[model samples]
Target: MSKGRLLDGVSPIEGISPTDSLDTLFLKSGSSTAHSPQSLRAKPWPARPQQLCKGIRGWRWWDSALDVVVVMLPIPFFVLAAAVIFVNGKIVDQEQFTILNHSIKGATTLFPICFAAITGRAAIKFATWKLEQGTTIGVLEQLMGSRTVASALTTQVQLRSFNVIGLLMIFVWSLSPLGAQSILHILYTPVLPTSTASSVAYMNSRQQSYSDPRPSSSFPGQWFNSLAIEMGSMLIAPTEVKISSMDINGNVKIPCQSSLLASGTPDSEGWVQTALMNATSNGSLVWSSLFGIPIELGTKLGNTTFSIESTYIELSCNNKTVESLEPDGQNGPRINFTYVSVAGPYFSAEDPDPLDPWIIGYRGVDITTYNDTDGSAYVFPLFCPDCLSSNFANKTIEAGTIAFQEFEGLDNANATTVFCNPYQRYVESEVSCMKTAATQQCQVTAQRDSVLPHMPPEITYLSFPLVALGLSALLPNVTPIHDATNEVQNYLVYDPLDPLTIMGEDNSVLTSGGSTPKFLSDVALSDIETRLGQILNAFVYGSTWNASIFLLGESIDNLQGHEFGGKNASFVPATRADIVAMIQNQTAAFTVPAVLRTQAQVYVCNFAWLGVFLFSTVVMLIGAITGVVFSRKTIVPDYLGYVSSLAKESPWIRMPDVGVNMDGMDKARLVKEVKVRLGDVSYVYGGYSEIGRLAFARLEETTKVKKGKLYV
Candidate 1:
């Protein structure tokens, strides 16, 4: 054999002796005088042994490569996931302020955390090895030799594969529809606009049309006539004359002609007896004729060509002559008389006879152009008056066109002019009056009763004049105007001292004797009367002769000439058919609000997906850099070097074997015998140098010796 090579392919310098300590052999080789084995046995061990790690895997280029693969493998997957997330983020961010947008943003933030947690486990395991400077298989390597342990362990490799596979799977799943949807929401869901509108609808029906059951107002027009004589030479010039006029074929005419002048005097008793016959023959119109004087007394008016002007008279209460009517003549007593005629019930603003049509119109249309998105709904209102006003001259929607199809009317300016303005004003005034009356009545009624009944139309249209308007003359003969006026005065002029007045107590037939229930609270009754009187005063002003004529003419014209003219007529009581026609011709007008209508939607803008993707890519790169910089190589045990040396040195021994202790033997002797037997057996099996070519050769079994055979 060559001097440089040893048996079993080990070099001579690397070889160790099995029979003796290798240190003793080396010392002997160096000594000049050769000492026997007895002298070597007297030497103690060189130094105490120290506990050190052994047979552990060490750092290698291949191990670093594996760790680098672990860190880099998921980077591409993370990049792909980031791209998808960025796209989803762009989609949701563009749709901001919605619930879905918020959800998508949250998901985008959460995905990274989820990935970190899932892969962090493997990272933690790798970190443990570097931090502790040990491996879980270190003890096994020491017992079985590093070569056997290295081939048996595959834990780290499997863990690296697990993390890579998980990252790839998560990345692939993120591209799915569900994953994308979780990142962002997109749908053409229609949403309501940020505004709304409302409109007023007019009452256009009158099913139960008839006279009011309550005491009805005679009429709303003015009547001009006279109580004085018209043909007679002599008559009384009265303070004022109340006239009762009739509408005969739409013309106002008084049935009786009364004059303010009443001339001639009545005769006394002696003249009555002497000149009664002569006076009757002479045909002179006298005041005695109005007093119901007999012909024998010669007190009668001689001329009977015309009837008496007075409707009623009261002469029974006058016992003296001068106490009677002195207005006709001052010479003798004539008659105490009262003239009844129609006075102004007057036009009421509250109960306008001819109400015009007015209203507000509201419309809600889809505003697709809002936010430049798919579509949204918006609402807006258009006041009819405002629309009709000059402020919207250019914006007025033409009637009868497609835009104004819902409205009922011709596009003629004449019709709109007549109805929209004059009639509209009428209707507005009536409505305002109605509202005021309703409020005032409600207040009074509430004070009297707990629950309010439905307002009666009589109260709605009833006009109670504050002053004794010709209305008192219109009352039936059963009730005297003077008596009512006196009683009303009592109720009007408040006296705090009187309990009955304060209590609103009344003995009048209007409340007593089953006529009607009287109000207990005088305050409440007075308030009601005052309010009603004011409302009537307002009503009477609006119900004038000229107004009545105009209203009647307009009604007739609309019903006969225009289509849908009477569609929105008022339910107000009309004494004449012409008046009803006026109310019927009214119509509530409206215009489409320009705000609700919008231009068509057009989505021509793109999302910021590309920008977001680039940003995410940058973030991913930062993450990769951080991961690479922070990463630590796994700390393999030192047993790897020992295994490499062993493989290089020896081929026969694959592992070290330790024997158990034997019982019933000297412990120290057994230990020495075990070492000596192993050494001798190894030498017999194979020599250190391959040149010797020694092998195990046994001829026969050796004889066993007992304790007796040995010397004592």
Candidate 2:
């Protein structure tokens, strides 16, 4: 309250003093600074709640730009990576339809997105903290001017924790060689092609796939049915990720390729007509898997998440090379480093640059040693940077140990036939593992139409949740509450009056209230609403979004003269549905939900309903009680008291509580008052001492002051 600057290191905290001038004192920023009225920044975009969240102009624009780029850039970048890789081996004379490339491309789209997500998330957090720090300091300045700097510094320091954590997460993910190695290894790992159909139809797995060059073979309606059910389940009920795969199995004997027709076997009504209807008239196709991984299975019909989906599965990868075929099986490879280049730099046996990041040495697979005669083993930069001679030397001989069925540019018949046999060819297998992972592990074999009737179709439950939620509405007896309670207890009936309340809780309330049935008791839902919402999301939103999309491409092909085709005209060859029904008539799909809740909803929803009243009522009371209790018991008074106490002290004297002494006061000693009395002795400003002699000496030339205080 005094007009003059307050005392130093004095009140509120004993033995500790504020600097007589703010520049000399130290104060903590952050929650402590909220007491100051001036430090807080006013809201921006007062009209929109979201915009209002962006308190600073600089921060707002940057966030918007970050979000936009994060959302948009990955799509094009993914396209570019695909375009580059897709035509790598295909673009010689013309291009061939290799759908696998597209799938590989699609999966890869998420790689960049992951990076964008990390960058966006980190930038957003940092910006938020910076903006908040400013706002906090501003508010503190409003309450007490001298403490502003200390408060600002404190808040900024506190918030840096978030950025540190975020950076650590990014660093861990990016730098983790193991994760990258696993993924890259997977990319290079060989994949073998299996018949998409079934092996049983082959009569044996030891032969080449039997192809069905059928013009009449077509899949049928159960696809649409499955599409509808799975989608319905997704839309109505909740869902989750049960990473699984179906292992289908069966056999078929087709008379000829033209007879292959594994279409619409289950009929619109859903039936499994086994025992090939006509081997001569129409060959049956029994499509199924053996060692398949079911990502998703089962179907959700109408209101209930009445889906019998999959056996719970956890991800398991087989990284170990099968010993039976591993190169080491014969005799763990021994690298023979016979001096290939005697004259090159580092002429010693160990070539410094020769595959510094060495390649794995194998026995019978593709092998390339130094081609001494051709000098093909010369060392060079892995990624060519030179304009000319970028492929300075032949670093790798692509045809190491591979034995191709046909050879185009080779003189020796045996050399071209085998992948590579640097040493004399022994009894080792000719071909290297089929160069791809996912393709290798999973074997798909096309079945005979007579084997069952059609290919077993896959079911996507995108619409399951909608059906669950909507049908839940329809079941006057099965509102959301009823169904949930019924699931819990058979005897429990849903009370329509209070739809939110379960029958059990309502009964408890009724009995307790002595017939004046309480509106709702046992109303406590869960603080873990986000978790459950996430669960619901897994069941609901995720199911809807990620569900194996039911592409009911309708053309004049089948069912009611509709053009069952794709979005543009891209063709979809198989409909796994018809094949599924052919396998089992009563085999209803197992539907599961996949959804998760986010942090934002929790903040907004509660704020939307509670409004200021939430804090105005309970929060303030709790805060007041806490402040009173804490202030009395703790060292250094609580926030409210600090505010009130600071109000009485003059501004220019106090400083933040950080361990810095700027005010030139004995920080360890408390002071009762501060005064700048010109005692004809020297006066101190910052660290400078100005006496009669010193003042006269320094300001001899200037007369900016009107015989009193210096103006500048």
TM-score of each: 0.20, 0.16
- Residue-by-residue lDDT tens digits, candidate 1, 1-712: 2232333433333344554333343243342233222322332322343332211233345635755664564455345444444443122234443544454466556545433432332333333343345444433222122112122123323333334433433343233223333334222223222221211112211111111112343232221111111101011111111111111111111110011012222234111111223322442212111111000101121111101011111011111111112222544222222211121121111211011111111111111121234322222212112112233323322121000001111111110100010001111100000012122100000001101111211111111221122222221111122322222223223332233442343322222334332221233432323322322222222222222221232232222233332233222223234333332333211111111211222222123543443344344344344434433333322222222223222322211221111111222222232211101112221333332321111111011223333210
- Clash counts per candidate, in order, are 35, 133
lDDT of 1: 0.24
Residues 184-265, model 2: lDDT tens digits: 2222212222111111000111101111112231211222233334323322322111111111111111111111223434
Prediction 2 TM-score vs. true? 0.16
**Candidate 2: which stretches are off by over 4 Å?**
1-63, 73-183, 188-193, 196-712
RMSD in Å for all candidates: 31.8, 38.3
The candidate 1 region of ten consecutive residues with least summed lDDT is 441-450
Model 2: lDDT of residue 254: 13
Global fold similarity of model 1 (TM-score): 0.20
